[model samples]
Target: MPMTSHRAALQAWLEAMPFRREAVAHLMAAQEAVYLVGGSVRDALLGRHGYDLDVVTEGSAMALGRRLADALRGAFFVMDREHDVARVVVRQGEAHYHVDLAGLRAKEIEGDLRARDFTINAMAVPLRPGLGELLDPTGGLDDLRRRVLRAAYEGAFRDDPVRIIRGVRMAGAFGLHWQPETEALALATVEALRGVSPERLRDELFNILALPSAASALEHPVGQRTLPLILLLDPLDLEGALEPVRLLEQALAGAVWVGAPYGEALEGYLRQTLSVGRERRQLLKLAALHLGCGAAAPQKAEETARHLRLSRREGIHLRLALQALDDPLWRAESEPEPLSIYRYYRQVGEAGVSGALLALWAWPKGSTGERMARRAHRIIAAWFTQKGTLVEPAPLLSGQEIVRKFGLTPGPQIGALLEALREAQAAGQVHDRAEAWHYLKRLIEKGLS
Candidate 1:
């Protein structure tokens, strides 16, 4: 798309948003000099929805924030005095809109542009009346057209090493190539990344991985440099060093669980792979231990689960994936019986079963793995429909119930009995409260004898 047309469309879109337009008008009328800046402009130029809009001005960010709050009836927050950034959050029932105002430290617009990480982001659109021109003093438009990432200034990395990850993220997000000089600077900035806080590093790594093209960037030479830096920060000697690119490829290509546990694991992987810190490494270990059901042996799965502090739901997902991995034929056969389907559901809960099926579908074709995954999805779907529900059976008795009914002391034996009962119920050996009670009674009697 032509830059002129792209800018026109973006202007139209921004003008259409009554609230944003009003906010811009409020800032402009004050004569403090404000311009729409940062990611919002970058994303708009790229023809994407920009969620957060940032504005830079010569006026006090806190003062502008208060004025905007009063005009829009929004809540204002003074973010940081050091940075001179303030946020105004405007809410209209379910919808939320954010407007940020920041102070400009530079003498000229070029100085502000030079302070940004990349050329594309350095470009800004002036909101002042008759000043609608895109101020691209740093050849941002040229770099954007070339789909090349370039540092705004030579000392950009020295000022903020987190830009290394941001560069990778933008490359993946925009499918842009880093300029040779930019690539060199990224490498030079690697050591500086160590000086950044772990939380900031963690956020950047995850944001990069979450991008659709992240898998490809992971394999890139620039992406590879991230690995050693991570290891240096948080050393972990596995049986062997994991190929970071290949691992990301597998993860991106595979069906990902988008739950709390999965999120935790992804964060952990980024941190551990990057060697973020000991606390982060431990979090990743926990997440990996609970990733897939049946992917590992039962004993190993249990051990890993205990070690990593996985929740019940996470443990269930890991176990189900492991189980699906074990029975290649379960997913290979064209038509699986009800019993097989029931067994699959029994092992993995509904979400886990769905996750397993997705993993199978993601398997590359012309391999036994692909065929197995295809067949597994077919069988699982058929059984799920036949049952009209794929809910995992609830435990017939609770731990407290076991204590009350078995006349057993409050100890480890109570847990053993409850687990045994649940297994029996899952195996279809026991049904209803009466059967559960009788079974527990027999186990308690046998133990006493």
Candidate 2:
């Protein structure tokens, strides 16, 4: 659709949202001049709605935010007291709307728009009766129409270097192109990005990783130029890393659980929350990307995490994911069989499979690599079918029972024996407790004790 049509359609559709009316009424009651600003305006004009809403007001932003929070029965937080920026989180069932209230940067809305980082996000709309008209002094609407991301000013990046990261992320997320001038400005100011707060950098990097076509975007010129600079300490070979990320995405794209009992469980496990809003899948893919280059993956991952200020769990997952690539087992020509898979599962639990699969995907797509890939896929599918047995099993014999029956003292031998029993159970050797006891007795009789 043309940009003009999108704008018209979104404008027509905007008034129908129930929250707008409630929000406008509450803000108007406070007698503050509030304008729906930033991404909310941009998204609404692009035919998307009900995401987070950013609002700028002439009066105290925190005061109005508290009022709106109370009116909407939401939780409120003061983001920046000096800037009078506050946030209210409104929950509706499973969905959440974050309404950000900030004092106007300038006396007028146009000046406020000019001070913004990107033109596409500089537009605004009044939060009052009739909702007034769309405010686009910086030609944000035109940029949005062109699918071009333009900076409001050349100094935008210098003012807030985080915008450089955000610019690439936005381009990737929205299929946006950097306007010529904006691209040049960004390139010139790229070095400043390294000095930004680790927390801010981490947030933006995670946003890119969370995207569906993250690798493609990172391979884009802007991302290609900036990403390595951001993680300059341990530069990424993005070309080498794309394959596994693409494969992981493909694996998770469909109704992966169809006809598989553990499909849902496996999907849920991969999607499990890690630290600081990072997911297991994100960290695993990150590990794959880092491991693609060469050795020193663990050190590289640690340095990257430290620079980005990633959470402890995120760092640990990355290190674990690299294990498969680093281990000699996967480097062999022959593919890992069921026993090897069970051994790997015991070695690292869930992360072991994820890492092994990433390694197989990253391999060259020839006869050997194809064989390994197929083997990995089959092993994963079979594991999913028997995930219950793989994850946990009822112990056939207890340590106390072994000690009492065999006259063996508590020591490393006991732990080793139990682990062996568990492995046997995993490999279908021991079914019943009697069978397990018999198996143990045979081992003892064979002088294995």
Candidate 3:
């Protein structure tokens, strides 16, 4: 889109947004020259709405944040007292937005713009009513028009190496290609990336993974060159890492149904909420990529997750993806029988869906292997579709029932018997109470139960 058309669209969109006006009014009451700078201005020009608004002013940023928070009945937080930066968080039901205030880092708005990381993020607009003119000192509008991501200056990466990770996210989110100079500068600062804090690295990583085209983001040449530097550890199996992502994309697209209830259910599985962020599905796929779909993947997942300092909940999600690699049905070259699928659901529960997705492409492509993989996929789908009935049926014999019937003590033996009975029910070997008792007698006769 041309700059003229984008400007018109931006104006229409900005005019339609009434939420921002309240906060702007609060800022105006302070009688300071304030401008809506950074991401808010960039997103507005690029036709993106609902992004956090960054406001820069000559007055104390902390005071401005407190004023806005008080007026809007929002929460005020001091982001960086030393740098005169603060934030006001406003919540409306389940939705939330941030309005960040910061003192000018340099003498003028142009200097502040030049000191930013990217050309596309170095634009600003007035927050004062009737004075909403764009202040683009770095030609951010032109770069947005061209769909090219360019560094604001050569030292942008050197200033904060984390920007390289943000670049990967922007590539996937906005479909912007990095300029050669920007890419070169970013690669040159690979060593400096090690100095970045783990929390920042972890946040950027999840943010990148959260994108719909996350696979493309990781597989893209830019990501290929940047990931190793950011990860900063052992050499990853890059091809192995990309395969599960490709499989996940296929599953999400309905090309592969490997055992999720429906395509939408599987999609919802991928979008499942996590303790930290709501990208559990994407993180699980990334985990599968890192730990190849092999028997030893779970151990590798543990080691890698520890090295990355993942949160406790994130570790659980990663383990679930790795656990898929350990499914025994995959060991059988033939299609999994109904009993095998039931047994899998019994063991892994809902997590099996994610595991199956990761393991789908890990299987061989030979004719026999393809058939087995498809069968495994169908079993997963059936487990989701029939979870209440076949997958988790009400066992005819409980632990207490086994203890009472056989005159045995309530011990591990009775628990084992209960498990056996449930397995029998799932395998279709026993149905009603009479058949369950008969099956138990056969197990005792064979000395198995």
Candidate 4:
């Protein structure tokens, strides 16, 4: 792994991955000074498999992005029209990845690398074979060799404080030691984070939480480097919530499983994306982070969710997980009955999946630990296996039925009753149409009373 060979190795790594050659080949056709830059270069050097390809070109980056999309059979988006940033996204079956192409920030590759955040990310290789040698103007190669993380310049964090979060994440992700000055600089710039957009802060936080070391790094025994960011969470009780995250990350990373039987379901539960494509695992951590926050967890979850600009689905998932951290199963020394489990799921809906993990991991493993494990296992199994029967029974009473039968207007009451009936059905009190009608009638009577 000599410095020269890094470029050659990256060229081969590009060929092996799905999108690289097609993107580089198309960009090479442009006669622009196309170079593989940023993490696309760093990750390849470390032999880490990465789906993202970062490219900078002398020509219009957006135009090249559209052409690369056409060449790679992907979709192109003008991610930042004013900033001359564009993205090409490609889907590979169940998973999707992207390439971001941007016009050079500076006049040349050397200047562009100098303006980047970190030395390791500041290295680049020409996209066209034999066009040039590996470019390392800022000692990125030396930093990588020393396994040390360093800011590209003194003002890197000041320029974009979100890089501080990214710096911590990369440190955890690659196990790179912080050059003391870089760490000091990043810490000094924490207040500047307030000026950063909520979206940028959020995406970087997500990236940080996605790391296997996220929980420990954020709450490290020595000191939590991310405490400044956590304090921004205010009353959410986000601090000291890493236990659930620790467990969740372990399962997601295949370091542990919820048990062999429900392994697939548990993985899917953690991996599934919300409507806005944000990860459930990250939101789960946020929900449980406030477990110590008690009554404030739900409100804090909602407030923080709004600040993060999470999708409606994502917000509900986070808020609900916090809302219902305590459950019958977690309380009971024995596994709760199906009806209890059904009620729990009914209360939180889809957040039940996340809440279950939070509860399971946060459950202590002493004395009755085995029972709680069994309880968690059964509850999670029901979510994937028996949800149709015991958890979310097919609704017998539709909203249309309520409006027609009850002579009621299409309003809040109808919606409330319809949702309640699903839980009632789970209670096994309403098995058939006749029983469902009687159950609704009793509910209406009870409401009027």
Candidate 5:
């Protein structure tokens, strides 16, 4: 089905759905007016299916929530008081739908719309019979049609400075431009973001950077400055410090799902690039800096890994990519040895290596770069498939093993030895129990002598 037809069908289905209809009936029967508001209405108009539904009422949100919970047998969580919002979680098959019920303090719908953050989100569709119409008192539909973001009021930013980041996120997500007034509001409110909590600011920053068009949005001078400053609480006055961030954003844009590896990489990159005192920025920077470099240079790769604060596992990936890029032998082969490929699996762990390979393949490149990346990918795949499949190799020596074998007491040395052995095993030096014993024996003997 076409996008438009699908959306229209969904809208019709939602309107007729038992849950929505029941909620509408309950609200009206209780003498309270309700409207299907926010993202659901906005997305339906934009020809998209909204996963979450937000309902606003003119009366008691708690009372409405309990009533709806009883009707639908859904779980009700009265999570907030200041906003008078209650959350209902309803399950359908594997997907869970969230319905938010909010009580309005305003005397009229127009006043309620004016209290919202952005014009596009300020529109509401009434759920009652005579009021079952779009009460877009703020011209949100026009803003949506124009693909522009506008603040609902002058005080909107003052109410919540975090909305500025949200505006950037929306602009990136929908490919919309901010209105001139909205842009000015965002710029002026940039300083007010200092008042927001660090954790909230961190979350908003991650959301913005994780978007596909995040790169394009970050390329905007104002956005670049604003985002970094929000994170660091200090200014980054560089002309183009956001260039790498843009590259990362664009590279990750096509991903169907952004998982742990992506999050780890992004977190590391932001910490280093932003110079924020949050935690382990240097480590994230190291991982990100070596992101696109294929098996190029071993010494440089190791150094880069050390600089970026990568764990032993991450360092192995950097080493493998560097080695592959530098390998004239791999380039010479119509098919590289299974051993060489097994080494790749052994070194980086399969998931990390595979993720690195995909990153290399997706890295912005010309014709030659593309061909090399494709060839490298094929070689890596073939090697893994031909081999008996990579399994996470168990440590040859544990802390207990170290204590038992070496007659060592519990101490930092035991921990340090265990770590060394694990790194050696990952690097493929010690293949078995005997090798591990001998390696430890030799280290002990050398140090004692």
Candidate 6:
């Protein structure tokens, strides 16, 4: 799509609301400068389809947002009560949108544009007599045309250093090289990111890593400053450190990530949703990056998770993936013992899939690396196809049943024997209940002898 005026998109977006566009139209009637501002305008100009709406007006943003929320049958959230900021969250089929409403920080639209972090985001289109009239106080349209990113003002990063993270992510996402001034400002103020709140830093970092071209985003020079401080990795070029991440991406896309074959077995697993709209792919990529931490990789992963406030589920995934790098069970062989596959899933649970993929990426460095990657492929295959034994094998005899049959009580002995029985079952030694009992009896007799 060619870069075009966003007036049609803005119109269609407003019209799509369930309660019609009356709520916003009413607000526009009451407010002198009700406008679609910031990134929404920028994205629309770039021919990007986005549902999130950023609106700024002179009137009470809270009241307007509430009305809009009710109109769209969406949930309303007060972002900043003091600042008269509110958000409306609504979903249209699979697409979700957060329509953020805020009263103008500056008195005029021009001042608001001048105050944003980047030029492209500073533009606004009025929801008035003529939406065609583009507000280009900072020349966002021109910058978009040039495919360049520029800071809106010299103090853009100083006023809120969080913009440093935002700038790099946006720059990479848009594939726009930073203007020299923007790059200098980002480099000079990179250290200021340490002072930013953890939540702010985490959200931005996750957003950065979540980008489709995350490696490209991390390659931004800004990450050289932010990553070591935030991610706790040794000072290294993010491109090289993230090679595993790129490999994982290829594997997820069903490509040759060190010769692993992609097939029906991986389709759904690869498309797993970590939480809400967040994909497991993002955390998987993060795990691959931390794999470069060498001996202290797990510790560094822990610190990074804590620093970023990663969810417990996400933390577990990273630990499992990195751990798989050195695990004995991570063998890639054509026909391996079922015990190894069973033990792997048992040890790592759901993260075994993540671990397998990481192992595929990490174990391709030397002669052993090739062997391990092929083993990782077999593990993935078992996970998808041989799940009856390897992925989720049912126990032949429950611990309660074992206790009843053996005239024993529920204790550690029963638990240990049950695990032994399960392992035997995984080894294909015990199938029926009689076979399971016979195996246990032999173990008991051997132990006594």
What number of clashing residue pairs does each candidate have, in the order they appear? Answer: 15, 0, 2, 0, 11, 6
Query: Considering only N, C-alpha and C atoms within 3 Å, which residue pairs clash in candidate 3?
Result: 259-380, 259-381
Best by TM-score: 2
Ranking by TM-score: 2, 6, 3, 4, 1, 5
The most accurate candidate by lDDT is 4
lDDT of each: 0.63, 0.75, 0.75, 0.76, 0.61, 0.75
Worst 10 residues of 5 by lDDT: 278-287
Candidate 2 lDDT, 1-449, residue by residue in tens:
23465446545545667666566668756687888788887777766655477889989998889888999999999999998999999888887778889999998888999999999889887766546778888898888878999999878999998898889888888888889889888888888876787788778888888888787777666776777766654344545666677766765665543766557766776778878478777776677667556677776876787777787766766776676555555666776645566676666666765775676664346777766666656556655665656434568789999989999998887787887777777778888889889888887777666
lDDT of 3 by residue, 110-129 (tens): 89989999999898876666
Q: Write the per-residue lDDT of candidate 1 for residues 114-188, one digit (tens) a residue.
A: 799988889888777733778887888788889999998898888888888888878878888989998998887
Cα TM-score per model = 0.71, 0.91, 0.88, 0.84, 0.66, 0.89
Candidate numbers, best lDDT first, in rank order? 4, 6, 2, 3, 1, 5
lDDT of 3: 0.75
lDDT of 4 by residue, 325-353 (tens): 66655777556876788888878887877
Candidate 5 per-residue lDDT, tens place, 28-93, comes to 566677877777778767766645778888888888888887776789999788889898887767
* Clashing pairs in model 2, backbone N/Cα/C closer than 3 A: none
lDDT of 1 at 64: 82
Off by over 4 Å in 2: 1-17, 234-239, 254-262, 326-335
lDDT of 5 at 410: 90
* Model 1: residues with Cα > 4 Å off, grouped in runs: 2-7, 231-362, 365-368, 371-392, 398-410, 441-449
RMSD to native for every prediction? 7.6, 2.6, 3.0, 4.0, 8.6, 3.2
